[model samples]
Target: MLKNYVAYVRVSTTKQFIHGVSIAEQRRAITQYATLQQLNIIDWYEEIQSAARGRRPVFREMLKALKRHHYGLIMHKIDRGARNLRDWADIGDLIDEGIDVRFTFYFFGGVVWRGTDKKIERVFLWIGGSPP
Candidate 1:
């Protein structure tokens, strides 16, 4: 059976909107990645607020849902998922709790939190062509 995942995408500034990193683009990429990985995306959480400013309602909602459902999380990129240290730490906490967090961007390779050592291992899985 395929693992259930929640997809989270965000765009903070107008610059990002103009640069083609719109929520739609992120969603599309995430959907494609999910399909390729054979993972089932049960829900989507999108935030237009800047993570740097803190207090994202949608993000908080997603976190709450994750805690309750124990579903995996897939984001377009690390920055989209978390631009601040606190938010990053939250994600780390989830990983520490055995929650799976994945990024759609191939450039990120893959991030895994090892046991008690707290070591992070990067497993690169390049699909095709050169790195973006």
Candidate 2:
């Protein structure tokens, strides 16, 4: 189901690049995961800069692409890929538009969440997953 995915991986600093914290690792890992699932990687993205200092304009551009209904997006490490609520909101936007996002580190909120699409009751269920 996630075969048609684009892999995104990033590291914030040159030190991370030289020290083996690189998108190459993300590609390899995503490739492996995709292979196991019998999926195909349609495209890939890598950023060698920080989400905090804004070294990933391209990454943001790519997120814009995700809104076009790309099947899935992959990130080797969640923190390396994003750093705040705005960025997370952007990610959620993609999901709301029917894009599946995968993070090697974070599990997302579990069920897909869309402020525009979800009913208030569904929102409540999502918020209170542990029901009585």
Candidate 3:
């Protein structure tokens, strides 16, 4: 069966958005990863909020939609998804509710992190070519 997903991208500063760190890059990375996994991106949520802050309106709305539709969530990285422990806890809650969370790019020689099991496992994945 094809998996459902909702993509999210965030930037901390306008400089990041302007100086080549745009949402397009994030979405591209996510799209690449999703294509590799054969997952369908049902929606996208982009935000210009600091991860240090837990109160993100678009993030909240995305969470509500994910719960309502029972779709998985995708992000560029773990830090991009949640910077603080509280925010991480919120994500953990979603995981407990049986939501799959996939991190597209990571420094650990992989482009995805599937977190839907009883114990989160770090499976290595390379989308395009050889891992750098």
Candidate 4:
């Protein structure tokens, strides 16, 4: 019964527009996801913060929106999310609260975990993932 949908993209450096196409590529990927699912992205949040920084303003805004409870959150990649455990836990708490999460790429084929068990596996993947 999930209907609401939103897209989020981020880059560590603001110069990505000039140096590379990270943000553009991420947007295209998210757009593709939205198109495939026939969902209209109500909002697309983009931040210029590294995953190491837990207090990203745009990320905080996204969380506030998520908590307000409308649509779910979508992202280009999980690492675009958070590299630290605290940020990861914040996202986990959101998931526990029933906020839907979708990744641009399901490296593991959409393995959605609702319990703490698969969490360790995610942690392992986070630390030692091979390039895809």
Q: Which candidate number would show the highest TM-score if scored against the true structure?
A: 3
Worst 10 residues of 4 by lDDT: 107-116
Q: Where does candidate 4 stray beyond 4 Å? A: 18-21, 107-132
User: Model 2, 1-132: lDDT tens per residue?
Assistant: 445877787777778776675656667677776675566678777777778754578788788777765767777665766586566557666766777666543323243322334442353355437642
Model 3 stretches with alpha carbons more than 4 Å out: 117-132
Note the clash tally of each candidate. Answer: 0, 0, 0, 0
Error of 2 at 52 (Å): 1.3
For all predictions, the C-alpha RMSD in Å is: 8.0, 6.1, 7.8, 5.4
TM-score of each: 0.78, 0.71, 0.81, 0.75
Error of 1 at 69 (Å): 0.7
Q: 2 or 4: which has the higher lDDT? A: 4
Model 4 lDDT tens row, 1-132: 437777888888878754664888888878887777766788989888787858688888888898886577788778888678777777777777777777766622475432234663465456546632
lDDT of 1 by residue, 1-21 (tens): 999999998888777765778
C-alpha root-mean-square deviation, candidate 2: 6.1
Who wins the lDDT comparison?
Answer: 3
What pairs collide in candidate 3? none
lDDT (CA) per prediction: 0.76, 0.65, 0.77, 0.73
**Considering lDDT, which of the candidate structures 1 and 2 is the better prediction for this target?**
1
